[model samples]
Target: MKGHTIGELRIGQSASFTKTISEHDVYTFAGVTGDLNPAHIDEVYAKGTQFRGRIAHGMLSAGLISAVIGMQLPGPGTIYVGQELSFRAPVRIGDTITATVTVEQLDPGRNRAVLRTVCTDQDGTCVVDGTTRIMPPKE
Candidate 1:
């Protein structure tokens, strides 16, 4: 995606992208965040948990929304100010999840935008929902 400016955005507009959840991503996120929870890394251990198999971390799936904003929309030099998230479903290895962001509100004076974000699996099941606040560069 190309870079964009704050003036380029319009309220109610949206952008979306998809990514496959891999075992490697889960393990790497565990290593990076030190969240070595069995549910995310151990299939055997996870089978005994409520998830019934290895599942990605809630934050890991949520992070895809950040990737969308930082790399796709309002990309490069965008400053994140806040986020609100709700985990709705478990993201399993091999699932193809799509992350979407819609411009909800824009504060032109502050160069900030409020976006409604969501991550959904291949079956159109919502895995995560949230709002993100970001200041896309003026120039």
Candidate 2:
């Protein structure tokens, strides 16, 4: 499927996806990325950290934003170029995260788009927020 071209996009255009963090997901992410940090894998070790329990890898939630951009908005053939992110809160296993992407700005002349990306937990806490730039497929 072709992606939304610049001409078809508008400011405030948005999309999202939600997922519940699970132990298997975290472990799989850790195994694949080789980021076996204690906070993500070792409950006993994590208990001593500021979070007082295990927390999912921050990028796991960030990946959800990618889902929205690649599958929802300027979807399918969209090319991800740049991303800036900030992890605002800890996300634990079993927490549901909703990742949202809104068109905050567009540079049609450059075939560029900047989207406001946010990930919120079930409690409505903003666990992650950032911006991403993409070159939406013109076709």
Candidate 3:
């Protein structure tokens, strides 16, 4: 994968990645991050919550946005500078998510790009929305 240098990027450039959330994905993420929130791990407890069932960790879905920045739009060697995310919906096991990033602004002088990030489910529901700042590879 070849990454774009800051000078090579343009406003409105975009890329996406898709993956289906599996039960194992949720379990592994919870274990790795130590975020054993019942809403993510314990079905019985989750049944009592507003979600009424286990849901994938918000960050796990947000990571798909990071995947786009690091592996697709700017490709490899991208440096994440900042991100602001709003979780809009629950991601259940077996939900396929498509994460997309669009270049909203660019600062070649600073080698930075501002990207609009969004993740949608199979039904086209927006599950995660955010903006991120990244420094593309300096090539």
lDDT winner: 2
lDDT per residue (tens digit) for residues 31-132 in model 3: 899999889989999999998899999999999998988888898999999999999999999999999999999998888999999999999999999999
Report lDDT (Cα) of residue 79, candidate 3. Answer: 93
Cα deviation of 77, candidate 3, in Å? 0.7
Across residues 1-139, which tens digit of lDDT does each residue of candidate 1 receive? 4556789999888878899999899989999999999988877998999878989999988888988888878777777899999999999999999999999999888888899999999999999999999988667
Q: CA lDDT, every prediction?
A: 0.89, 0.95, 0.93
| lDDT score for residue 69 of model 3 | 86
The candidates, ranked best first by lDDT, are: 2, 3, 1
Q: Which ten residues in a row have the lowest lDDT in candidate 3?
A: 1-10
Residue-pair clashes, model 2:
0
Could you tell me the lDDT of residue 97 within candidate 3? 98
Model 2 lDDT per residue over 114-135, tens place: 9999999999999999999999
Off by over 4 Å in 2: none
TM-score of each: 0.95, 0.98, 0.97
Candidate 1, superposed: residue stretches over 4 Å from native: none
Tell me how many clashing residue pairs each candidate has: 0, 0, 0
